[model samples]
Target: MSFVSEFRSFIAKGNVVDLAVGIIIGGAFTGIVNSLVNDVVMPVVSVVVGGIDFSNYFFPLNSAVTATTLDAAKEQGAVFAYGKFLTVIINFLILAWIIFLMVKGVNKLRAAEEKKPVEAAPAPPPADIALLSEIRDLLKNR
Candidate 1:
């Protein structure tokens, strides 16, 4: 086949297009999870622990990375973002918990299905026994 034809076929079937859509949705989902972790959950946590932005919470490594907080490190062109890492870790933990609950619900449904009783088919009578009963009836001369 020609290269154009193959390329056209690849585009027509839509695997690549589907992948692009999936990537876009995944990006959006990540943004939502990140916001939930950084904005909503963390603030609630901060209230309990005297209000601190964990994303801005970090330690300075050296003088090259000037400034006291994580924002300063980035301002002076520092490579470290330990606070970002912590925020990501928090997101991962929350996502993991949500996934665990979904899986647990699926398992419970599977268990309920398994617990359901299966019916057994009735047994057929033996041909020899049926024949013997017929012969006995004949002998009795009904």
Candidate 2:
């Protein structure tokens, strides 16, 4: 097949389409999670922890370059931005927890569906067996 045809065939697959949809949804979900962490969770946490911004927490490696914020420190010299790492870790934990709850709920729904009793249609007897049974019944009546 030609390159364009091969590419078209690959993109036409169900799994590939599902994966693309998943990626788009995941990106949107990430934005929501980020907003939840930054706007809601962080503010509440900051209040509880004396209103300290974790992004501003960093250690300057160079004595000559003294900066308050992580960005400023980077402009001057090398600095260990542990605070940003901590914030990222917190975001990841929250996202993971939300995903876990979603998966758990989906699993519960699936389990409920599985537990439902399925009423199957009764099978018909073979023609020969049915005829023999009918003859036996007639003989018994006689």
Candidate 3:
């Protein structure tokens, strides 16, 4: 096959299409996960922990940097931004947990499907085949 044909065939493969779709869906899912962590979960967590904003949590490396927020501190000088890192870690953990639950649920469904009992006996032969068999048996007797 020519290069163009080979390339087309590769792209047309089921796994390649599935992977492309997965990547697109994953990108959209990342946005949803980010929003959940930043808007919903973080706010609830902030309330529980007395309204502390993790994004602004950082240690200024330079003595000259006196800004409170991480962004402002970075504007002034370098800072160790552990709070942002913590938030990202939390987001990753939540996303991983959700994916794990989804996979577990799918596996359970597959197992249940597989466990369903199959038909114990095979179906009877077609009419013509049964008639042929009867004639064959009669010839053998003669």
Q: After superposition, how far is residue 104 of candidate 2 from its true place, in Å?
A: 0.8
Over 4 Å off in model 2, which ranges? 1-10, 122-142
Q: Give the per-residue lDDT digits (tens) of candidate 3, residues 64-95.
A: 99998888899999999999898999999999
User: Positional deviation of 27 in candidate 1, in angstroms?
Assistant: 5.9
lDDT of each: 0.81, 0.90, 0.94
Q: Could you tell me which residue pairs clash in candidate 2?
A: none
Instruction: Please give the ranking of all candidate structures by lDDT, highest first, separated by commas.
Output: 3, 2, 1
Q: Which whole-number lDDT from 0 to 100 does residue 90 have in model 3?
A: 90
Across residues 89-142, which tens digit of lDDT does each residue of candidate 2 receive?
989999899889999999999999999999898888999999999999999999
Candidate 3 vs. true structure, TM-score:
0.81
Measured with C-alpha atoms, the lDDT of residue 52 in candidate 1 is 66
TM-score of each: 0.58, 0.76, 0.81
| Residue 74 displacement (Å), model 2 | 2.1
Off by over 4 Å in 1: 1-29, 119-142
In angstroms, how far off is 137's CA in candidate 3? 20
Model 1, residue 21: C-alpha shift (Å): 11
Give per-candidate clash totals: 0, 0, 0
